[model samples]
Target chain A: MPQPSTRNRLLEHAEAVFRQKGFDGASVQDITRAADVPKGSFYNHFDSKQDLAVEIVHRYAGGTDLSPLGEGDSPVARLRAYLLGELERTEITGVEFGCLLGTFASDSATAGDRVREAVGEALASRSASLARTIEEGQATGAITARRPAGVLATFLVDALEGAILRAKTAVGPSTAAEEIDIALDALRP
Target chain B: MPQPSTRNRLLEHAEAVFRQKGFDGASVQDITRAADVPKGSFYNHFDSKQDLAVEIVHRYAGGTDLSPLGEGDSPVARLRAYLLGELERTEITGVEFGCLLGTFASDSATAGDRVREAVGEALASRSASLARTIEEGQATGAITARRPAGVLATFLVDALEGAILRAKTAVGPSTAAEEIDIALDALRP
Candidate 1:
């Protein structure tokens, strides 16, 4: 096992705390204290707490290997795989803070261009990947949607994020699953 | 128009700040200071910040009489009324703090039963009301959902909330409006 670096440790601990406290609620002191790093060392690693948050989101989303999702036999299976992975990850991490993309979307302070661009990238990438899978399913006559692949993918993402928001508030994952199930049914061949 | 009562002023200001800044971010000082109430008077009004937040969520959702939605021509119209009202209100407010129910959903501190129940009640009430609307729509052949009214309503609420989540984040009501348009099209007979 690769031993965790100081930077990695900071990122992991920060992600966990931010997931719990939110951007405004979280403080730099809390993160440093949680990570067992000297307060000054935090600045050494990242420009600001906002910078750290952006990196944390990138890591959280990328840290999950999406290969399994694409490996599923059918488009629906692939999409389900992606969503189920998200559900299990949240349950396990107890981070259940909602999707970082959606969370940022709900945030007003995220008006900074850099942060918005990063989140926009994450949203676009997820949507595009899902759209590709959906399009392939359509080619095979395995799925149908009144909206085009991109629009449907956008709706699915929107619904999933909303479900996550509800789940986060309700402190349960059941609604997220239900929402995904409905979206899947709607996209059925 | 009846002049705003002190309590109403406090609640209104608190709602705006809380939605814009969040529970931890919006301090009693900020709320009271905004409302021009004596700082000490805050304790006289609510038990604590958490207590204030609970009241805020209840007051915002409760203050609005749903009779307009309930009296719409059909279930689809009723549901649209509920959603469109939210969209318009959020747009006009320009605070874009996201929905109170949704804001809580993202905060991990809201895991407690009391807080969860408060948020859940708001959601459940909305969902039930929307289900009635869907039933009416289906009966009139204005909506063509194949699922039970309850299930379809749940989907619509979740999707609409997700759309609002995006809108709040973007600080633009257009996002929610666009998503609602798609949702409405889907429900068309």
Candidate 2:
């Protein structure tokens, strides 16, 4: 009912713009325009567009709901649920919007040091968590892949990102879920 | 031979800038600056920044040497060689530089319709070629997976793009080759 604070509004709008247009692709004016706030008020909240991007990275990574990973009894099944849940999300929002963390990963050139650092940490942390789950799966005999869990974890995450990027510009009816499924099946014993 | 033409110079430098900073991140001034040409001359060579980007997409895709795919006797090894050859390139250019086609794929928002079309066509064409090779591999029984060649091909290309993106923003020692190798092994019969 009550209006959110200006700072929160700025963050929400900035996230949308960043996800859609990437860090450098979207300008301060663009974010402010989307937020319907005066351009001058932008600097009042964030020091620079890059500053806003760093905050966004922190928030996006911190707020990610990994509860889907807890859905299934087996670790691999849970990982499948986690990944499929991601695809279902883009199914609702449209795949072209992309994930903010992934957008920043691909936009490191224009994203500057602070933003890159935040994205790097977020992606690394996510991959690390996935690796831990995969290791558990391996220990429990749910997964038979021989490669190190860390390696597989990183590969799977990268595959997800690649599928997302391809799906965004794809001319045909390619769904990221199918590509990711090919990956999940590969990990089976 | 005489010095390279101004137009050729713009194309080369524009490629460098776009590969480094992405389509929307680099301005016309940035291209001209990198090319050591006057800002006014940019319009003379191309109608606009987006126009030049489309041209770059065509040239980059058209110039990619998939011959490494012909390197080994087996189709899959050749594919590995081809993918490794791509990694060798970014190793020399710096992994942070990224592929122009992929940069455009991730930058579709600010890349405009024409650039997106060019990127989409190029990616589709590459994926199709990979699929054809994969079909050849499957016929020879080099690849064991039962997934359709088209699906497998799209999965491979998407995986490559994802590995590249992760390598760009990686904080640790994750190499694209290792991640890609994981994908290749997953194709084992």
Top lDDT prediction, candidate number: 2
State model 2's lDDT.
0.81
lDDT per residue as tens, model 1, B111-131: 355666677677777777778
Q: TM-score for chain A of every candidate model?
A: 0.87, 0.92
- Which portions of model 2 miss their true places by more than 4 Å? none
| Best candidate (score: DockQ) | 2
Candidate 2, residue A45: lDDT: 92
lDDT of 1 at B75: 65
Model 1 CA deviation exceeding 4 Å by range: A1-3, A110-113, A171-173, B1-5, B64-68, B71-74, B108-113, B137-148, B171-175, B181-189
- Candidate 2: residue pairs that collide: none
Reference-based lDDT, residue A73, model 2 = 69
Evaluate model 2: give its TM-score: 0.95
- Candidate 1 is scored at a TM of 0.86
Tell me the DockQ of each model, to 2 decimals. 0.48, 0.72
Q: Which 10-residue window in model 2 chain B sums to the lowest lDDT?
A: B68-77
